[model samples]
Target: MFRILNNSDTFITIGREYVLEKYDKKREEWLHIPLKANIGFQADGMIIDSGSETSFFASFDTFNYNFPKGDYRIIKVLSSEGDGILLYDDFKIDK
Candidate 1:
């Protein structure tokens, strides 16, 4: 789970992806999936500030369909500019 609060006056757009780790009796591997809507595949990818500090919530429930019970990590990539800094990398989902 991620709660982003844009304290700045302007809106920000951030690109996101999930680095999921799936484990079985054999081995474990990672999978990357882009964060987008299931129906449209459109990237709205922007956060709008509503005068006051705007709060945005993001989660990766989509992986439930493809991945079985395991461990996972979500990484938020700031792809707008400069080195693509990783914003968040602590999110772990387990089942």
Candidate 2:
């Protein structure tokens, strides 16, 4: 899947692309979706991806979170920089 989306700004004209790789040691193929843009908020580290899933934003060095005492699971996802990122979900933030 090689889809291109133009993300141009007043000083630049950039775009995003998605690449797929196959015949590796893993499954049939892999999806590489790169969201190249200069808009909104940016995570210093990395994050997961979804076809149309909503992702939250938070800075551990700035925000305070009261995580419940419960079991959780971590899932890995691909980022725009072609890197694997593990994100923790099912958690709540304090008001």
Candidate 3:
């Protein structure tokens, strides 16, 4: 799950992408899931309005088939125009 808060008074159009990561025992490293999907607001490719916060829910099934239950991190890539920002770095999912 993710939340976007628009503090500005005007509407904000943003593009978003999500990346999932988990530890790989064999390689002793954290591996990123290959699923590159968009995080939409209200509707697919929709814009968020002023003083509104929106939450996006992502299911494990959306990333892969039969995803293992463990500690995982969700990376949110948010962009407006050509500038991109990475957020929710400390957020983790333990299932």
- What C-alpha lDDT do the candidate models reach, one value each? 0.47, 0.29, 0.63
For model 3, state the Cα shift of residue 19 in Å.
1.7
- lDDT score, candidate 3, position 44: 43
Model 3 CA lDDT for position 26:
79
lDDT of 3 by residue, 44-88 (tens): 455778888778776665564345765566777655554665765
Where model 3 places Cα greater than 4 Å from the true spot, the runs are: 8-11, 24-29, 36-44, 89-95
Q: What is the lDDT of residue 75 in candidate 1?
A: 54
- Write candidate 2's Cα lDDT for 3-91 as tens digits: 22223221211112112122222454432322235423333442223332333333332213233333322223334544333332333
Number of the top candidate by lDDT?
3
Q: What digit string (tens of lDDT, one per residue) describes model 1 on residues 1-95?
A: 45555555455556444344433435555555543465222355654353433334444455444554655555555433334445544433455
Worst lDDT 10-window in candidate 3: 35-44
Q: Would you list the rank order by TM-score, best first? A: 3, 1, 2
Task: List per-candidate RMSD values in Å.
Answer: 5.5, 16.5, 4.8
Candidates sorted on lDDT, descending: 3, 1, 2
